[model samples]
Target: MDATQQEILERLNASGKGTVLEALDISVVEATKEKVVASMPISSKHLQLVGYLHGGVSVVLAETVASLASVMNIDTARQMAFGLEINANHLRPKRDGQLFAVATPIHMGRTTHVWDVRISDEKEKLICISRCTVAVVDRPPDDGDPLFKK
Candidate 1:
């Protein structure tokens, strides 16, 4: 991987340390300005009571990859990406193995970005398809901001 891609992976892995991403075992395996690839294990932690992967788990993976893709394309020093909306269709039940999600941009705009994320199982069978919209916002100034006060 190139420096940019390596940087993206390092940053993402670090940020997952204390978040739901960590709990769900999500990690970015590859990334570029136009696309991102991530994966999560389909363990009991991600399964519904019915023993299949939870739909919400798929949505989280979708939003995560899409939002990360949006962030990768922006100036992170001054901007941040937030998921504005997301929708996912779970097409297959996965009880084991890892699920991979690949996100590609549908629209990349100054204020907003749209991405299509496809999740497939280890066998490359489609598990979910999702679309996510992200809003890019300027980072709030840190100086004297109550939210940033420590």
Candidate 2:
């Protein structure tokens, strides 16, 4: 990875503290202009009562990486990306392994961005495929909100 990608990954990992990403143990492994990759371990925390990875967990992973990719493509000082819609299709079930999600942009417009995220097991077998649409809105002046404060 280049310097900028490393910086982006660092910032992403840092920002996950105390968030769902941290709770789910999601980590960004690669980031670039074209794609962003994240991984989560399929531990008990991520499984449902049926002993399989919960569908919600897969959706969360998809949205997180897709939103991150959209944010990476925009100027953070001036804009913010918010997920507008997301859909996921689970193809396979995973019990105990690492899941990797890769997000690639499908459409990058001035007001919106769309991304396709594919989640796979450690062996590279597709587990889920997701698409997310993110809205890019101008950032309002920070009013001491911790989320908006740099």
Candidate 3:
């Protein structure tokens, strides 16, 4: 990882609004200015009722990868980026083996950021594709919420 990439991952590890991918042990396979790749093994813990990888799991992986991209976009500015919208479509169901996701930035601007996330399996077959938009804010949205847990 380059100095800038390492700096971004450092902040992501310290972030509070963490990914659901953590439960699956998603590993960062590649990280660069061009694209980011993350992977995880498909195990029973990640499966649903029929012994197939849960569709929701794929969505989480896609979103998490995109979230990482968004975080990297704002690390230098110390700004918070929160997903404003996400659209996902599942093309295939992954039953076993490993799943990987690649996230690339479509647009990175001052106020809004967009990312294209593609999730595939061991054979490099597309399982899910998603688009996420994050809004860059000066502070987290919890500003007006109660300090105590609800």
Candidate 4:
């Protein structure tokens, strides 16, 4: 990766501090204008009662990478990207190891973005496929709510 790509990856990873991303130990391992990739360890914290990876956690990783990719495509100073919708089809069950999610843009529009995210295991086995729609809108004026402001 080039310096710019490394910087983007670091920034994206740092932005997750104190959030669920940090709690889940998710980190952006690759990033570019067209795609973003992240990985999360499948620890006990991420398992269901039967010791399988929780489906919702897959969605979280999917949206997180896709939304981060969307942010990289826009000007954060004036624009914001929000997940409008996401659909995931879980194809396999994972018990341990790491889950890697790669998100690529399907459509990049002025008002919205559609991303295709494929989640796979360390062995490159497909686990889930997700398509996420992100809404791009003007950032609202700072009204003191950090949630909206950021």
Task: Give the clashing residue pairs of candidate 4, or none.
Answer: none
Which residue window of length 10 is worst by lDDT in model 1? 141-150
Q: For residues 1-150, could you state the per-residue lDDT of candidate 4 as single tens digits?
A: 234776667777877889999999999999887989999999999999999999999999999999988888887767888999999999999999999999999999999999999999999999999999999988788633232234
Q: How many pairs of residues collide in each model?
A: 0, 0, 0, 0
lDDT of each: 0.87, 0.90, 0.75, 0.90
> Compared to the true structure, candidate 3 yields what TM-score?
0.78
Question: Pairing residues by index, what is the TM-score of model 2?
Answer: 0.92
Runs with alpha carbons beyond 4 Å of true place in candidate 3: 1-19, 140-150
Model 1, global lDDT = 0.87
Worst 10 residues of 3 by lDDT: 141-150
For residues 35-139, could you state the per-residue lDDT of candidate 2 as single tens digits? 999999999999999899999999999999998898778877778889999999999988999999999999999999999999999999999999999999988
Q: Judging by TM-score against the true structure, name the best candidate.
A: 2
User: Model 3: per-residue lDDT, tens digit, 1-150?
Assistant: 346666545444434234455667787766666677888899898899999888888777887777667766665444666778888898988778998899999998898888999998889999889998878778545453211123
Displacement of residue 82 (Cα, Å) in model 1 is: 0.5
Score every model by TM-score: 0.91, 0.92, 0.78, 0.91
Please give me the total number of clashing residue pairs in predicted model 3: 0
Tell me the tens digit of each residue's lDDT in model 1 across 36-85.
Answer: 99999888989899898999999999999998898788877678889999
After superposing candidate 1 on the true structure, give the runs of residues whose Cα lies further than 4 Å from its correct spot.
1-4, 143-150
lDDT of 4 at 66: 90
